[model samples]
Target: MRALTHLRSLLGSILEKKGAAWPDKATIEPPKDKQFGDMACNVAMLTAGKLGMKPRDLAEVLKSELLAADPALSKVEVAGPGFLNVTFAPAFWQKTVEEVLEVKHCFGKFNLGRGRKVQVEFVSANPTGPLHIGHGRGAAVGDCVARILRAMDYEVSTEYYINDAGRQMRLLGESIWVRCLELLKKPVTYPEDWYKGEYIIDLARELLTLKGSALCDLPPAEGQDICYEYGMKSILDGIKKDLADFRVEHQVWFSEKSLVAAGAVERTLEDLKSRGLAYEDDGAAWMDTTRYGDDKNRVLRKSTGELTYFASDIAYHADKYARGFNTVVDIWGADHHGYVPRMKAAVQALGRDADDLKVILVQLVNLLRGGEQIAMSTRAGQFETLADVCAEVGVDAARFMFLSRKSDSHLDFDLDLVKQQSMDNPVYYVQYAHARICSLFAKAAERGVAMPECSPALLARLDTPEDLDLMRLMEQYPDTLANAAQTLSPHVVSFYLRELAGLLHRYYSANPVLAASDEDLMRARMLMLAAVAEVVRSGLELLGVSAPEKM
Candidate 1:
């Protein structure tokens, strides 16, 4: 701890003197390879260019400064060119780990969020249908963002902005109602534009059971409205249940229809107009989005005077900012990338900073079976719903797979790999690592062994590459969490878990936790194994995945 403390300060001082306004926040990241040293920094190289000096020379100076500052580093050496190689005293590793045990999973936590009130609005799919796989990824990403923000110490609010409005719901209702009548021997064919999904038929049956011929023999227009309500509610309820099983719960379900019914759209338009950010053009109201770097200005209200999704978004964001959130993050599908500029323009036009709104576009998922993509037809309801995938691979595996990839990258949710119960499945491997530790601990207890406190043997004990590798890996866990929180990428933790499990499995195979000699060594190694378990479980928990103690 003293070594790391001194090194951070020394580096900060050296960088400040190089005339580039102190590297306000520079992370002393662990180098990818241990042979390079316990930790490595490009800070010297970074500052060397700014200082107009050779990087190697700069590193030499910093090395001396670090050594003088903290002798406990064991050795501070420069490797390659300008790479600052830092070594922790063996005792330093032991003591710092005591801190890990004391702090538990709370280790490496920072005041990054500082309790700022931020809300994540995601999976606002219309209640017109069950959630499909695409919707599942968004839910996982959005929910994880909220989870990370909260863990980073923010006053986070997670919301589900229900798209309960729009013509789609009406069409859905009409489709279901007609499908109902069609099933009842009324033989009603849907309008050319009505929904053709099988869900419509089921909804129609439910409506018939409750309303009987009361809804039958009626005009499609009347039945459309009634059935739209019926189908929408049914679908919405179904979506909520599906999401809840995936561990997604909303602090609020902000309604799309309410923005219009409550007159927020008109009020927001007026607010924009008052700020000279909006105006009428060719019988349409346009927001000067070009000012905010949009390709062209956008229509807020159509020539017909109906508000577009943009207008509702403006109102929605207005409400988000009004709720006292200094920053608002919107996670959306990649197809909505073109919509980002206009939304930010709206946020700014409402007298708030456009930069305050961060829109993350997660690319679409390509659901696959065997090795080929499974093309889906939403119209005929041939697409796999989130619920369907859950039923096939289970909620845990489904959610874990969705969170494994960078949300920006198009993920292929391979039905085959997810169902695999072997090392091929990374989630299973990580969970098994946790479970293996439990098995080892149980084995120890069966032999009347108890966990040992830190001792001279445990202190001098960890010398194996696997052992040090695990320690160094554990050290990165906190910063890993902080960085994941910073980028809103919970997948980083997923990736880290794989590496952690890899280390655990390798260590288990290379060395035995229950040894012949040195009973204290067994206890010491087991204590480290416990640390591995705790870290893996903590990381998995943030992603809403299970850290199984028994597979």
Candidate 2:
């Protein structure tokens, strides 16, 4: 990273001398092929036209200036039309080990956000039932996004929006009430449309235990209300426990009912009307979402005067912006893909840029065992709870696999694959690399050999191609984290870790660290592995997975 920073500065100074503005688009990165060089820059192609020079000519000048300005740059060549391929001296890369050791766990952190406030609201499933595997993916993606943002120095607050005040809550209550009647051996008609999960029966038993037969003696409406409150609280408590067990936590649990109780929905409608965005039509209050690109106007209040869920969502997001979040991220199910445009329209109507509202739609997880898809039905009460999956596989495996791809891509969560302790399992492979390094340290200590302090002379001994390749990959951690933050994809980190692990595994097989002919070589390799272990731990922490000391 220091190499990159220094190169950028040098190029900036050179462009300043040439009286051409430094292009923000200019980038220095690792070339795709290692044979090309350690790093490549596109400054010439980015600035050649502005300076009235050919790209190749500009590239040559850059190459000459780079070699003249930095003694660490061993080779600089103009490759192709306008690219500068750079190779650093062996000593320059050797110092990277020292840098990683010096920074330790904070090696990949960057101040990209600079304390900007960000709100990530995710896994806000209705309290009608336990979270299924689909909700698990959202939890992992949103939580890891928050973690990655924080690693980039963003002031992030996570939230779970509880859809408590809705028809679903009423149905949940009636479902429990019917179940309570059945438990008491009373005759009752169970509606086909009601929630039929076994958890509803469990809730009924809990309510009966708490209030006794007297609860059923109350009027149906009154008894349903009681069941509603009890069911909501019990289910919400279970959701909280399940999320916590999965290593996902939210700073806030915002209730939709609270928004309505505080008159925020009415206030939001008033603001929209004041902006000429809302009007009364057909005995209902409608928001002119069409003006903001929605295909049709959205109703805020129905003819019967019931506020729609969209109205409450607008109010919630209004509250979010009023709370001073520079950016608001919503993690929703992929089924809500059609809803994104309308949500963006609402945010724009609320006076925020559409870009400020980031929505990530997570696809459903296809839970599998032995390559066979498992059937899941939330309404039928025959689905795998997130807690069940975590208990069976593990929090680490579940979290990692949930983040193994883009949020919008379907994920096949094969139960048996994750439970395997082989290289085919990504989480296991990455974690094993860390454990292997730890074992090396333990072995060295048992053999009475201490890791040497990093120095140019000591690290120079690690000049093998494999040694340098490992160090080069280790040095890219900050870049990988930055890319992840920019793309809002924690899977980048997952992919990077897998590559690092694979390289480390291959390097370990080819090069013996503890059995080296010279004691100092052993010490240098130990220090390098220590830095590698630190990077692995940091990456896994960002993914909310543990770096175990042993497999």
Q: Give the top-scoring candidate (TM-score).
A: 2
TM-score of 2: 0.97
lDDT digits (tens) for residues 130-161 of candidate 1: 88999999999898888878888989888888
RMSD of each: 2.5, 1.4
> Relative to the true structure, how large is the alpha-carbon lDDT of every model?
0.81, 0.93
Clashing pairs in 2: none
Model 1 regions more than 4 Å off: 1-6, 13-27, 42-58, 79-81, 187-189, 455-457
- Model 2 residue runs over 4 Å out of place are none
Candidate 2 Cα deviation (angstroms), residue 452: 1.3
Whole-model lDDT, model 1:
0.81
Candidate 1 weakest ten by summed lDDT: 18-27
